[model samples]
Target chain A: MADFSYYIFCAMLLGGALVVLLSRGYVNAAMGMLCSMLGAAGLMVLMQCYFLAFVMVSVYAGSVLVLFVFVVMLIGDVKENSSIWRKIGIVGLWVVLGAFVGWVSPMLSQAAAGLSKTTEVVFLSQAKNYGLVLMTEFMLPFQIAGALLLAAMIGVMVVAKNPSRKKARRELV
Target chain B: MSYLINQTATCMPALLGTADCSYADMALFIVLKVVFALAAIIVIMCFAALSVVAERKVCAYIQGRYGPNRTAIPIIAAIPLVGNFLKKNGLMQLVADGLKFLLKEDPLPAHVSKLWYLAAPIMSLSPILICACLIPFGVWWDSGGAAHPLAAANIDVSLLAVLAIGALGVYGAIMAGWSSNSKFPYMGAIRASAQVISYELTMALAAMSVVLYMGSVSDSPLSLFEIASAQEQSWFFMTQPLAALLFIVALFAETNRLPFDMAESETDLVSGFHTEYGSFKFGLFFVGEYGHVALGSALFIILFLGAWNPLPYISYPESWGWISTLLGFITFLVKISAMIFFFIWVRWTLPRFRYDQVMALCWKCLMPLALANLVFYMAIAAI
Candidate 1:
């Protein structure tokens, strides 16, 4: 049953990606992206990453996709303006991907042959497990990344809130 | 992999009995669970319908108005005392209202996005319906001494999953408003998206505070059942009243109830996002909104109000088994009903907040308070 679900989710993910690439309407693309995210989350659930799956759905489909749709609606639906060359390029990229997958299959098997023989189901991605790892083993890197993000946010605000530029705009008005 | 196989094999019998079931039996059990879940959703829809009537009755009583108590069928009125009581009390109004919705014409407006316009109500309703499975109404201890939850989808990260599902409902309203191709609905949708997103932060944060508290208290994973069981000594509401208050307030906004119902403020936006919607589609939206309320209430009870516990700090014993489970179920239902009543009471009593004021309250007030609460709990936990 899990395998069946995995196959279904894989099909849905591919279908959604195709829809995103091929759909004319922006909202349709957003909806397709939503479907793709949901499919990905289902695959995560199949892997027992339940917390990650829920987080992906909540953050990506729930919030980020809503923002995407909101922006799409705000701008209104626009016809896809891709040239024939771009479409050809996208199709050619897919062909390349397929060829690369075929070529790498043997190499992947060779790499797998060198790996340790550990067969236990590792439920390492549960939220509690994640929290423990983040706060203990990866604490420094996590804090650094957080600080970097905070700095970036502050930089954006400072750039956007230039007093001189605002004064000039106010004067013009 | 073997665990997964074993789970699939034994899951049905774990809840039903100790019978070694075959594939068909397992399939039948799943089918039965799905049926039960659907039935539960229908019951929520019924609750929504009744809540509408109750709202009218409560509002009328408060304002000294008669409301819709006189809409009775003549034949039913001739069945003596019970009929007169039903007629006088507007018992059939729910039937009448349902029929009206069913019989009414659903006209698609010109120049509207037909697909999204039609899909909006379904999108709105689906999240809450799916989230209902995460709620554990009761926990029956079987003869084999294993506790079996009376829920459809029993996942470890159920709280997070439900919240995720709740957040998805905003799309339905946005889709409805934007697809309508009209000014009022457009504004309503925009407001709804903004409001829901903003309040969602506070809602999650407040719930996180509860989670942090539970984590510290019980040393268990952050599941709703774990949190409930942790409250055996004292409910989280008693310890974390501030978070509870923030959760309740944010829930009102999240469900788009009054005081934060900027999405559908009748005065300014002319019935808000559903202005273009009519008939059964509109009824679906209605059911969806009430489902959010009911689900939100259930979450509140589970998180802070001591879910399935008869009294505060007085949890049911596991040794009592089925009797305790039944009482737990009753306790859950009673808590949910009380919470629903509280929602209605607030809706009738308070005035709606202006859109700007609503945003300000969420971002400036509630968000900060929830963050502080989280930090405070974290500090205490660390200590």
Candidate 2:
């Protein structure tokens, strides 16, 4: 049952994320992105990295995709540029697909083999253990993530809020 | 290299004492770590709920209106095991506030497609959830006095995982604005993306200093634990204070918290991407933001603060015996809370930044600083 769910989640994650990457409509892409994020989180859970999985859900699906949709709204009618999608479609999409498949398969297989190698599973306890380590041992990265946030804060105000030099052009589709 | 450290750490107890410490058992520990993280999550969520009250009371105090003084109930927790004691105001103020959110109108404008609009908050909250897994709270906790694994999944590439997932929080803001099909939210989203992506590089490189130090130790590569344990007399902050400061600032920006919260500056963005959302869905985004804050604080605790070490100046505590692990866990919480409180204090004290200044700081200031910090770290580590 667990293996079955794992496969389903991985397929959805990869497929949904790719849909987001490839789709023209920002809304459709965001939707696909949302599903992919959830799927990714689920996969992380299956892989036993519960903390990373939850963070993926909290940060990506929760914040990033919302921002993407927001950008579309701000840009408005600028999105009608069918030529961009056509260009991507006409170009090396197959190559991107092939590369993705090539990378994911082996990692997934390794993770699968690693999981089967272990026994004595205590799922929730691992999350708790993660708490202890973050608190005690790996304290530096803990602090650095904070400084990163501050800089990012300053960056957003400058980049997103900085007005464009030229007139606001038409929105891209 | 991390694995070797983990093996040595685990086997130390059996090598010296009596418990059977095995890697397979350590793997089971991944699940155990996740359960303990619930306290951190619950603690912060409890505070964020209180933050709503804090925000309201402050607003009222400024306007001379009475606020939230009436909701205090007889302090008693009703739950089974630990809930027998009288609690604080029943801790129900947030619940009351949460109910209001649920009853409020959830309005999606006619111009927007309903599907994307409804999905924004959940989407926003989801990714931050995944990032928490790599964090190790306390070494393992059990009867056997063996060294325990800390995180749920301590993958070799957790730094990469953190960077990749932390980058995702931008989506929630972007999605909320775009799906609403509103003008202001959309603008908020675009600003958010540029701001977020720019700082990410600095964050990654700033982190690289430690990784470089650890990775470069050719004679004996330090696991995160060993590096953590190595600080007998000092935290890395003493040597890399500038980088530590830089990282904290970046973390605030990373989480879109106040002063740094340009993504949804109230004066201009008009609630930003989430303007169209209401009730629990909106609450999800709000809580998610706090969740980001909480996770960021936790990360700060682990990476630069010397993690579970009780004090930076003391090095190894004389009492750091089998009994001290429990105290280490408690002290860790206090540190995290202190950090979280700093976030709130900054939010209350500072005004929001103008978008231009925010961008200029990241590219011009932080990026350069981060690069310089990297060079310095490498130079010193090389010696």
Over A1-173, each residue of candidate 2 has an lDDT whose tens digit, in order, gives 35567778977887776776666676676677777778978777666565567567646664566556555555553443567767577446845886898999999987877866345554432333565567876689998998999999999878877465434543331
- The CA lDDT at B243 in model 1 is 94
Candidate 1 off by > 4 Å: A83-119, A136-145, A159-173, B1-22, B73-78, B144-146
DockQ of each: 0.43, 0.10
- Relative to the true structure, candidate 2 reaches a TM of 0.67
C-alpha positional error of residue A134 in candidate 2 after TM-score superposition, expressed in Å? 29
Number of clashes found in candidate 2: 154
lDDT of 1 by residue, B21-67 (tens): 56675676667668768866765666677777777777787788987
Best by lDDT, which number? 1
Q: Tens-digit lDDT track for model 1 on A1-173?
A: 55577888987787787778777788878878888898999888777788889999999988878878777777777978888888778777766886798799999977876673545545755577878867987799999999998999999888888699879999999
Q: How many clashes show up per model?
A: 0, 154
